[model samples]
Target: MKPPCYLIVLAFLPSFSFCEIVVKGDGILQDTSLTKNEATPTKPQASKPDPAGDDLILFDNGDVMHGTFGGIQGGLLWERKDIDRPIKFSIPAIRQVVFKGSSGVVMEKETSFITLVSGDRIPGKIVSLDDKSLVVKSSVVGDLKIPREHIKSLSPNPFDGELFYSGPYNSNGWMILDYRKTKEKDKAKEIAGEEKKPKKEVIQENGKVKEESSAWIHSGASFYSLDNRALVYPDANMPDIGRLKFKAKWKGRLNLTLALHSDFTRVLPAEKKEEPKAEEAEEIEDGEKPKAEGEQKPRKKEQPEKQDPAPLQKERLVDFRKNNAFQNIAWINPSKRTHADMFGTGYTMTLYSSYPNLSRNYFSETGVARTQRMASVRSNISLSEGGDAEIEIRYNRKESLMILFINGTYAAQWNDLGGFPGDGTGFGIVNNTSNARVRISEVMITSWNGMTDSANSMIHPDRDLVLLGNGTDRFSGQVIEIKDGVALLKSAYMNAEIPVKDLSKIVLKKSTSTDLDSDDLSEDLTWAKEPMTIIYKPFGKIRLNPISAERNLLSGNSPFFGEITVDLSSAAMLRFTEGSPDLSDWFDDL
Candidate 1:
């Protein structure tokens, strides 16, 4: 078989296809039936793989190949776009390979120039280079500045070794150099032209940053870091730049006072070097310039410094145990209170007199008058011996319980007093058969104790106590006390205080009455004179006129005239005495 001639012509064209490579002396394309001579195929060159240090450049295609260096000292490697293999390069051949990303500019040929991603490029002699940034200087574009982070890789510029003066020893780190030796023609003026003039000073004080002594500004208010590269300060939003004045002090340890504002030019007392003299002030006023102070003095401007508000006052606590005992007594009495009075407006002062020897024959002239609801009678017994005895009388009311207690014991109960025997002045002992001398001590008249409501804690307004007596010769030296359903008394003469309980046997007795009037029809005595009219404060006298002459019989002869009916609701204290209606004349009225 013979080889095809068309396949032979396509091998040597380097720009035609990407996959196939051509070989001239090798018998790869010869006849299949014939064997080529292994010796001397036109003195064939060695096509061994390229060394790793040899420059190889890669294109966008999936081709792999070896290519020759392109620049002055083989500093660059290039390959045709129609190659069938990846192109490679020596690491040293790269001067400055800047990757400007998709639409960025590439370096044109062999100029010391590199274009930026924005297609702006300038040629320069590289002065310094590092991963972070780069410095370059050349005659074409004097002092070209670039960031090394923008460059993909770099080879050290040979000219920068000696004149750049790499400083000091370093570990595996980058080194800095002095780029001062590199000079350009009239470079100073060009540098001045590229620099900006001093406009205004903006300083940060307290929490605010201010400029032009006008307003405060924040970082993003008028300036922004564009992709962390350049600071973009828009003209419309450019901050007013100036200086500021400040004042400060220490309120206490760990606390500070800071106030900052405009007007920073005036010299302050803290920074003053010396006092001004009168002669120097006059000389300066004569138009000579003042000599310079050693350093600038900062003025202290007045401001509202931070301060704490006034602290609150707390209430004081007190202990209650140390006070006096009298302060704890709740002292109160009924007579001193004028608000709710049961007694009438005026009191009958003469009604407390004692009376004696009452008689019914004198009833017309006396104050004793009969009434259906009340009457009074008294039984007189003669005493042969002056000895002590009790007068036990029981006059019971059918509608209500009536008890007369003496000295804490029940004395008598009146269960039938509602039916008076004749509305008459009678002389009868409510109780019978007595031998001891008698005297009336105290009396308490009340409604049924059990029938009244317990909730009414106060004494019933309808209930009260009364006491009536004769002269000192008859019924003297008596004491009376009343509270709750009880009464107490001590009699004169014998003066013994007795405990009287129960109302069943109220007895008035004589110390010596030898013979009893047993079964005698007329033995019970009738009252010969009217009884004394006992005027009371709480209860009205029902059967008598208070101003009449019946009160004078307290020492008279009749039995009924000396009798006294105590309406317990009326006079709490009652004294009936034999006198000219004058209490001082009754000896026992006291």
Candidate 2:
């Protein structure tokens, strides 16, 4: 493969660069002349208009144009019907832009509500804070100043279904790694060495007695073999994480091994013991020394006894050897009830942790295995010193790495792991401490690299963007059609028709790109021959001036997966106009 002739990365853009570039009701706009699709992480190929309604492009000079969108090039919005002479509108002159679909983020306008002890709820952001009082910025009223003691709690605005799960504990799908009899059995395995040993037998080969090598006897520990109820996800339908592989079926399972927590595995410290009182007096300064008989010196206060680290059980097992770095597998496999997950099938690196130091222990599961093959890297920055902290573990399967961030601090990165079993394969967490607890506030499984983050920090990127806010979460894409309040949202991930009621907001963003003309921009146009309405049977209807389809499945892209076959099922139905051609008969035409 040859490198490109020019590779340019734009760090900054001119002021109001995207003002003129307009995104019509439809999110599809192919800008060929400016930056090519090869500019960055693969440019988006906008789908042609699917006839939602009469789309109006509102301008600053109080001008409105109603027509189907052809494409946007050189910061000009093109209006096309039969494509005679495409009407081009400058992107800058555009003022108000309205979309026909769901915003996909804010279903309804929401705000954080602060409930007062007086039973009054103020909806807004906690803008200012002080020891004595705080202020809340609300839309209905101006800044509300209330005593800190008067406020009860702040109720978070209800989010869409996008929040997977959050809280102090998820006891549903997690399994505890308990080692009771396994502890004794594990020690015996280390002594005798063997997951299982077949009865010894002698065989005669060529009239001579021969013996089999005893190497088959394994000297490793294993987990109790139970139909690991804890090795899977709590929910059946979760986003698949596309990072970390080398084994199959490693889905939705996190390395929660409670044994990983020190509070459960290490020994606790001895309690502080009171010091005995002194019976004899001591000398003070040379001149002030006590010389009187029966005179005693003042007793100093004894410092409180310091406590030691909490006690924890030693249940984790690892066999670190070569690239066969799965010493954990070696120990886990020996257990009578321990069932190794599919991810346990190959080489794995194993690293130990040290809480006294702030660092991550990196290991390869397949490098090697032995009693003590590899050493674990422990971080001096102790999570042990404080209470529960926020931890986010993300794996980018494309890079085959596991990254850990504690309290938004990058703690560790495990790149030794291989690729992911599948994209969006999620993971879970396991608690090891007996009394201590950790809570999860929320989890977001996203494909795009934080381009349109709505929660925590609502950073909306200015674009011809439409957010299809699903009940669970949302993805940004082009709005294909809006009929009867149901909008067909098209993106590279998945395609679906969502009721406009479920939408957060469908916004046509302001553009700042310079107006440059492209000659071949028309080549990407899809000219519709007959006007048709896509009867999205159950929900609503969509009109497509020129509709396109294939023999069986609808030729389209999925908002979740690229280039997916849209199964013509209960949700998908079609109707046509008076002069519309019979699609059944036009199967050959397809």
Candidate 3:
């Protein structure tokens, strides 16, 4: 059988974004972002595990707690444990819960169109709006909280990557700085040529000609990629990245910073050499003019010696540590000035700006305390008057770098002195205009774990334990020490070691938790050791290494229970205590 012509055509169209290239029966498309090809089918498939990344709970103050996610039990957390004294949270105290991976998620975006008093529009999802503050979420930048007074009104908006704040933006969650916006070029030309028309067509409104033909000028701004050709479509509709941070040292070692690279090539005129004076001297040795010979051999103007063009300036690559480092940064607004920023080791700081086109200068705090003085930055970067732009402000404890790119070109990079930034460093936006207000779609302060190359692995199981002598006997706790293969278990009441030979079933805990178990657990306390679930019941379902169950009595090792030979004849079950690398590497592998 022959494939349909359109399917054959689709095979060659490089413009399409099909995940698979196989031909279809009638050319009908298939949605296979998830699952597998249907050609090989089985009776049925088993239920899948949660597809998100690590189950992380972030605190409002910037601290993070990792756990296996024991669901809320009796208004208390259960399943896994890794928390400090009085392990408790009201659920509302959490800033957000970042799931394990992006699988099973729709990846759809719901945005809020914030209309500032200046009539500017920005898009994001409204997380909260109260008298004190307004918190918005972006698939790009995670969550952003702003002061209430800084906003005027908010309305829902459809998520379109290139629609408003998407073009040329990225998943890093663009902070649309609507400093200025300009109209389309054709509209500008139409208005320029409008004056040439008949006087009768030049009707004036509000002291200006109302040229409907030139209306396309204010159709809102658009953006292009670094090449300035393909329209940029920042995939900003992610569920929640939590943060976009990397280590001060990991700038060039990871995907986020490595992807920010841009190169520049410049050509300079060759140096001119002074021509010898002897030619002119020979032309007029004596002041007297000689009689012209018949058609005096036309002395071709002595061709000046050809000077070698100065070797083309070597193409330059952006250095995150040097001056004008942001020369390759991209921008969406139009400005004529540029700024510079610096970054080194230890501390980190950055500046964000959304300035009007006429505002020739902006200021930076770098990493220093404000002395009521704003360090002005003169910029050579420009975008449309009403469009927005963002800057990359990376700071260390001793230095900070601020880079701004505009209209697919490097604009400015500002460096200053201050402490390096840690997690949860907050930032804000201030409107310098009264009637021309702007909306800051996001105020991103990046933070993540892979910012360094230290040898230590930052991940461990949230909780680890073992089940011995038939599933009925269980012990949950940390493995403090191992001696000659005999593992030591540290539980609340006792710390004992169990031999490897006695092992029946061992469920590996995947997260590290700090919450202390209750000193008084019911004899029936039990939990299933799944990826993100807990089980606590059904004595018949319990299975484990065979136990010499002389009647109901069973033997297990314990510290507090003392007697080298412990018996579980009186209890129902047992429990244990719970919970980085490549990367870019998943934590579950360990």
Candidate 4:
């Protein structure tokens, strides 16, 4: 095939430049973009009004945008919709704003309290937040329990300065800015103590204005210092009233606050054990002889325990395999339960987590190939034939399970050994083959890569773009390699690989990184219409091969294999699941 030529494209490859851009909101734009029919929900695509656009606007928080309507306004993109209802929020709430670098969108609302895209509702006061989670407090909900990844946006009610008891035991009173230093407050107290006569202001018609005492807690990014501050215990009896003082900083080195003095007894070391030791070590002189390695045994490094990477929720794939004896007859029931399954005389088979090479010969109602063969290996569960088959696989933080359905009826069950060689530990599926006629019409897998809801939306790129490592959206890119069951994307600036199952939605967007005229830019993904080639080089070495169901798997009636080679590199991959296989079975049992 001739390499089609076009003018030089603005290659924003490997340059993961940090920039913020504007996302403009044109009033009442016709929203014709179709919702991607993904098992998992995804972020909506923006309709490109005109391409050839230049001058990307970066937001205050370092987000960049480039489409027809893109720009930052007041810490958020102006392009977002204002969903601030009168009762929900007096402060304006932006509905939907696209995050920079990828197609993720952030949604905001008010009075809805706190509901994450994942469906967890956190009802309480939001004390603090970051990109991934938030800390909230409520008597009913107790404390911070929601992660930011689950949230779409935060909606804070407008402060009315009215003290209301929102919690079971505490009242969120009016926030008065008490800027007076400790000395100034002390002087006021001394003066109040020196009063000789009954104070007219303190006494009302029936009673005196009582002084309110409570701890002011801030959970912002700054580190807090609790120096000699005493927390009053419920059981402790205090003499009339007493006070405690301490300081805390947000995202800083030290905390500050005045010491507390009270008759109520609650005593301990002022600082935590680790914090003081760290401080003490820093104060040691440079010339002073350090303790011998054995004398003062060095503290063992507390390595951040490696978290088992998130699990990949996979579905089954039933295609043709060369080594399998049942090439003509798709195993109506393959004993290997975890990976792929077949039934309906090979006409209708279900694929669970991964796609496999398949042939249409088995799909025909009747033929010389209408003969079934035993599975290449035995699966923990046996598969039975008759009627259309469906494979259901579920994934969680740890493992994945597979279930088989015949003619939409329950048939078989299996636990994926997890990785190849049945370690039951790895993610993704490969190194196996199946032959069936049915087109893999359905594939459902749980994912963490991208999620969507009223509050948050994430993008799960198709196989090609995800391998780019940088996670930037490119208009024209191709699949170059499948290493260790992972697909690698090749482009001028980007060279990265991703798990094949990670491909949920592939989007084609107008490249807005460099300066170009609006007339030259096209919003639709015209390039994607051409066939994408997945080059396979021994699943380890870089190679190119057109990954077409027809080309490599079958030519008319005969099976053929071809090979091409290429150079490739690396990219980090993140997998997440929406549901667990165990949960699916348990729910089914109920």
Number of the top-ranking candidate, with lDDT as the measure: 2
Q: Please write out the lDDT profile of model 3 over residues 1-590, one tens digit for every residue.
A: 44456535444433322223332333433211111112111111222332322344433232333333433332223122222222334443333333332121122333234433222233345555444555655432236554443344443322211121211111222121122234578667878887786665667646554521110000001111111111111222211111221111111111111111111111222356888698788767776466676756656798899986444432212221123111112222243112111111111222223331211111232322111222435365333333444433322322343343333234444444432222212221222222232322222233211122111121225444554533245577755543453556777889887763354323333332211254654333222231111111111011221222222232222111111222222221221211111111111212
Better of 2 and 4 by TM-score: 2
Best by TM-score: 2
- Answer with 1 or 4, whichever has the higher TM-score: 4
Reference-based TM-score of each model: 0.12, 0.25, 0.21, 0.17
Clash counts per candidate, in order, are: 76, 98, 86, 63
Model 2, TM vs. native:
0.25
Candidate 4 runs further than 4 Å off: 1-31, 34-76, 79-361, 364-590
- Candidate 1 on 281-374: residue-level lDDT in tens? 9888898455577855556788888886434322111111122110111111222221001111111000001211211111111222221211
Each model's lDDT comes to: 0.23, 0.32, 0.29, 0.24
In the range 220-240, model 4's lDDT, one tens digit per residue, is 101111121111111111111
Q: Which stretches in model 1 have alpha-carbon errors above 4 Å? A: 1-54, 57-62, 69-135, 138-143, 147-590
Candidate 3 versus the native: TM-score?
Answer: 0.21
Candidate 2: which stretches are off by over 4 Å? 1-161, 168-380, 399-401, 414-418, 422-426, 430-590
